[model samples]
Target: MPPRSAPTARQRRLGAELRKLRDSVGLSSTEAALRLKITQSRLSAIEGGRYGVSAERVRAFARLYDCRDAALVDALAGMTAPRRRNWWEEYRELLPAGLLDLAELEHHARTIRTAQVTHLPGLLQTVDYARTIFRQTIPELPPPMVEYRTSHRIKRQQVFWAHPPKPYSATIHEAALRMRFGGRQITREQLAHIVTMSERDHVTVRVIPFEAGSFPGAGQTVLYAEGTVPQLDTVQLDTEHGSEQLHSNAQLDKYRTFLDRFEAIALTPSASRGFINQILKAL
Candidate 1:
């Protein structure tokens, strides 16, 4: 098969893990390719996520690299399964690849944790609230584009409702809940929706009140997706330019610590709901 021109984040991550395995063993790409009886280009294509890899091949690579972590190897092998068409595919052309990648990441995550100060987590955002936020895009988005984004975001929320849904924990700052993006009515509805969603058995919503000032990761919005194994976990940051996916050990470690701190400073779920109710009542 021809090499993929644009590999999805999951695909890239699988390849990256394979590369890390080889690097840890101190083997150059050429040497590894020789051991695997493949051409240098073939190895590079696999490492670059341009070519498909079989689960069997992944296991073989793991053994060749002398990796002892069975859980990580199993996680890597599981990622090699054949791809299926997903809801995000329809927006392949209309929306940014990063958006689609995020949907896929959430779909596969064992658990999802997010922290936001300026905006609510995408998965928890309402249609009107999201559309209103989109309207503020610097260059401005067309009406149709805004609708597309809003619908896509709503669709992404399916993960929360799926059978045996993944556990979701969101830590939101009081500032985000107070921001009235679309006006009082919309903001009121959005906050109410959050309270309702937080009532679900599997959903957890915590709030960092104004009293909890100067917290770590106060300015950035982060989504930390826990994969089947910790080694496959990822941290996504919303940046001015676009979504940035980070999986390096150091990056993941830093974000893990940041998330822990956020949770530590956040109000309990019940208290958070009451806090939001207070904000809603004030509005």
Candidate 2:
């Protein structure tokens, strides 16, 4: 099959995991390719995520690498299945590739955790609140483009509505809840929506009040997407240019600690709901 011109982050991640397995066994790319009975170029393409890999091939590679973690092997093999048409595909030509990758990541995540400082989590933002934020884009998006993104952001909330809904936790700062993105009315609606969503059985919203004061990751917005296996967890950070995905063991560990720290100071679910309602009432 012809190589993909631009593989999604998921595709790249699968390749990276395979590469990790090979490296862990101390096999050079050339030696590994020779053992697999494929050309070095073919192995290169697969490792670069430019070529497709089948589930059988993934299992074969795991065996060749002498990997003993059956669960990790199974999870890696699972990622090699045929790609299905997902709702995010419609925006493939319109939005930044990172945005689509993010939706894809959330779609497959076993659990989703987010840390937001100045803005409410995208999945919890109301339509008007999302549209209002989009309008303030640096270059200033065209009206239609703004609408597209707003709708896309709203559509991403589907994860919360799915059967066996995905578990979602948000660690939000008091500043975010009070941002007033679309002025008072929109902010009020957004906070109310957050309260309502947090009440879901699978959703958790914890607020870090101003009294918490001077914490780590104060200005950062992060999303931690848990995979079927711990080895596959991914951390995504919002940057000025685009989304940055990190999955190295160290990176994963660091962000996990960050989330833990955030949660350490955050209000309990009941108290958070009351905090949000307090802000809503003041508005």
Candidate 3:
């Protein structure tokens, strides 16, 4: 099993609110459970943030505790609803915890902005492109493992088509456009695909030209996401060993600054599309 940690910020907040409610009503867990028509153990788990509470149950508990704070009750209800398991969970055995956490954050984000310097971002990669990249990794992954990882990446792309699809903005380096993933013919097809995808209303794709030289973001890739709640915005940095998630206010601020700087050095959407077409023709 993965090592356990303290509850997350959201979980802690929920637990504190529940504890306050119980105190206000002067009710013990057993008494509260009896009033709410649930077992004492269940109430204990909910208050401790070990188990998710149901919206209806949250309402019942709030009423029982004489919680007249309508806004707080609504917030609690939203927090307790069943969330879909992250798609990356299927790859739990193969991926590190940080990457899995980033995937979960991506699934829940309302907006995403990214910059890629050396390769196509996973969301934009074609199946052949993904396969080529995976097969080239050193230490030689087994064929089945490589296939599983590629399939997992494709599934991650489905988030773009989900109900109320999240908006995405990306700035890709020109070198990535020129790199031949699975050879020239496949690279041409991938470039053409990029042009088509960029035209979608929810996606913005820009190219940072080679001439945009030595910029603040010339070497690294970064992904920034805005969560459903304002406090959840996070930045993910991919490294050789693993990925890292940055959620501290200071780190998020720095990434936001980096994004603004990178955007300034990239081609406009229309120009980027024309640039991609030019590369496709040359290929």
Residue 228, model 1: Cα distance from true site in angstroms: 0.7
Cα lDDT tens digits, model 1, 193-269, are: 99999999999999999998788965899999999999899999889899889999999999999999999999999
Please provide, for model 2 over 164-203, each residue's C-alpha lDDT reduced to its tens digit, 9 standing for 90 to 100: 8999999999988888887888888888899999999999
- Among all windows of 10 consecutive residues in model 2, the one with the lowest summed lDDT is 212-221
How close to the true structure is residue 171 of candidate 3, measured as C-alpha lDDT?
91
Clashing residue pair totals per candidate (backbone < 3 A) = 0, 0, 0
Q: Worst ten-residue run, lDDT, model 3?
A: 1-10
Relative to the unseen true structure, what is the C-alpha lDDT of residue 57 in candidate 3, on a scale of 0 to 100?
Answer: 77
Q: Candidate 1, overall lDDT?
A: 0.94
Candidate 2 segments whose C-alpha is farther than 4 A from its true place:
none
Candidate 2 lDDT at 210 equals 100
**Which regions in candidate 3 have their CA more than 4 angstroms from the true location?**
1-80, 83-86
Count of backbone collisions in candidate 1: 0
Question: All models: lDDT?
Answer: 0.94, 0.94, 0.79
